[model samples]
Target: MANSSSTRGTSLDPRARRTRALLRAAVLDLSTEKDLDSITMSDIAQRAEVNRATVYLHYKDREDLLLDATESTMEGVVEAARACRLSVDTHALPDATPTHLISLFAQVDQHRAVYRQMLGEDGSARCATRLEHLLAQAWFEQLTAEPPGSPHETALQVRAHFLSGAVLAVIGRWTRGDFDGEGEDGGGGGGGNGNGNGMSVAEVADLTWALIRGQK
Candidate 1:
């Protein structure tokens, strides 16, 4: 399947771009209110203020549009992970979570609803797979940038995939409220504002970094 990057440089007429933007926004808005499985093409069209035919003209199906809509949300995560300094010397790692890592969790928290829906049991495999690949690619780049004694290509690939999958799993569970009340402050839960009682972004980021650095 074509990845989200496939559409990056493809030029669309101004009108077409506007229509796509509207449709993407409409779907994202609707997703927060209901399950993705229950949302129909006609519903998306109505929300976008376009006819049903217009929706089909832009996307092959609801999932295709959803993929497009949610694609932008992952960019912050990949960029933040790439910027992180995953030091090999555990002793050298900062006690506090890196700002980039915090940003990564904040990005995910900002879109908690969409992510919870997409990464849930009934969520889209394509979406999860795409995110995993992007994250793995970012980690692979970092590993390759290490000094001459770095791991072999196969080892790097394995480590990258493992790290990315672990990160995604944490994100998935956090969004699903599995970590609620464990590491959270007394703040209440509701808005995806990262201030919720269920594992704040900083707490998750700290835990994730601790695990990454092999700290107890």
Candidate 2:
């Protein structure tokens, strides 16, 4: 995730900004030819034109830095969903739609190398699980923001956990090449687009969002 400078959108301090920019740039450059584990803070510092201490000042460890980058990608996803008001039916279409979810997936696909690499075998699954928890937290907050609900936030939390797994399962399969041609008819297994044809991302997103919105 990007380190917020201030509520007003002021840029970060020049030195801090420089250090961060360097680290980000270093990751991009080295990732092209080296294993993430093989890259070191010193290497990043040199690439960024900074020093080890400077790298240390901004991030705790290499994993921490990588997590920051992952957040950067996720930030884009959330932004897109917001653009469509994922919460509202402004488009007058289903909660999920081919044009909508595919657009988001396409963006993620744009960073396929980074995502596929970071999502080492079991890595993406874990990342998706964590991401779902964050979503659940946000969902819970929204639930509690107004009057008490009939089913309670705890119930919603459980639903969120299951839904998170479902979402991850779809993404995992897609990454493994399971849904290449699934399209809009392959989401619900066994073909027919959950009974139609090709499992489309927007369709799956709609299914996922339905669960989210319908949670007790």
Candidate 3:
């Protein structure tokens, strides 16, 4: 997630941008097809139709490129989390799950396979840590934006950390098929008809929101 390649100025050449895009696409596609540890730089280069040296020019290593490719997919999740009204009075919150929350889960659902691999037991620690950081930062911003009576800074930090951890755990387990039997889709759910688990997008969202709000 701390790739120097990503920090390059917006003025990067068009061809460079195209090359980076191809490399990212290649890594992401390969991730869904095999275990990440087995994907080498040469594998990505071949898939992207670029020379091995070209891949090195853009990314320091395979992990750097993999993170860059996966980072783009979390933008929607971050935005949705930032927009959530986490500070609202529990009684006043809507009975229905917020559309933003649903969108957050849907965003993850769309990239389920990649996420499943990344957040699994054998997944990348960098990827998991980066996701947790982004989620905590998003929730922290939203909490700070609450009107005058918001919690103290330390309290906010605790809440943000708690939220991010909880959300990440839910997402990881969901993606790993831990919840495949929780809904009507039957055991071992894999079809996109649901969230790739047994629950629908909204159902999972509601469950997550309920847990966030400390409801039973």
Candidate 4:
């Protein structure tokens, strides 16, 4: 699962890297065409223009290939969050929170398709669980070194999981078209009149921050 270090190690020669990249891209493209359950190692290998045996050399099976393909996007999310946390801690960012948070959301927007497949109803629960765990761990680290004071260990765990879950839930909905265009809230309050796709990256970031800060 955590292949980041190994990926940079000697095991990944130039040819190996190219093969893996091709496999990942092929899986993603094929996913857009058909259900993941129907996808097989042969399908992926064929799409990547590689033999089935070659796929077996790099990945154990179809699930392995799918996870590897998705993890890159998830890693990007974590890395962006890490950078944002560092910026906040170092006071290097001008608007600190919002700017970096927006950047993180922008990265999410970039990988929305991947997230949709991983976190959606018919997708892999393993991928969603792993992403949540990573995000929660990152938040736990960030919260432990804060000013207003860190929570008790148990509370910190709860807070971290809650934060991660909340963020991902919102993101899943956003990417799934939950906030597309305008709709009344039954109170007849006018809607955002959005483009009917979803919130802009900035809007999502702003909304995310407000939620984190416990603001309306």
Q: Give each model a TM-score.
A: 0.89, 0.60, 0.89, 0.80
For residues 24-131, write the lDDT of model 1, one tens digit per residue: 888788878777677899889999999999988878777888888888688888999999866444577788789999899889877877778777778878888889
Badly placed stretches (over 4 Å) of model 3 are 1-8, 181-192, 195-197
TM-score of candidate 1 versus the correct structure, residues matched by position: 0.89
lDDT of 1 at 44: 91
lDDT of 2 by residue, 61-119 (tens): 77666655555566655444334333212233354444545555555554544444454
Q: lDDT of each structure?
A: 0.79, 0.52, 0.78, 0.69
What's the CA error at residue 180 for candidate 1, in Å? Answer: 1.1
Compose the digit string of candidate 4's lDDT tens values, residues 41-98.
9999999999999988888767777878877777768866655562123333344255
Model 4: C-alpha RMSD to truth?
A: 6.0
What is the per-residue lDDT of model 3 for residues 1-216, given as tens digits with 9 covering 90 to 100?
234355444677999999989988887888777867788998999999999999888777778887888886778888898888777355766777899999998888788777777787788778888888998998888788778886787889888998898999988777666776443223225533453436667777889998877789
Quote the RMSD, in angstroms, for model 1.
3.4
Q: Which candidate ranks first by lDDT, i.e. highest? A: 1
TM-score winner between 2 and 3, please give it: 3
Candidate 4: where are CA atoms >4 Å away? 4-10, 86-97, 147-149, 181-197
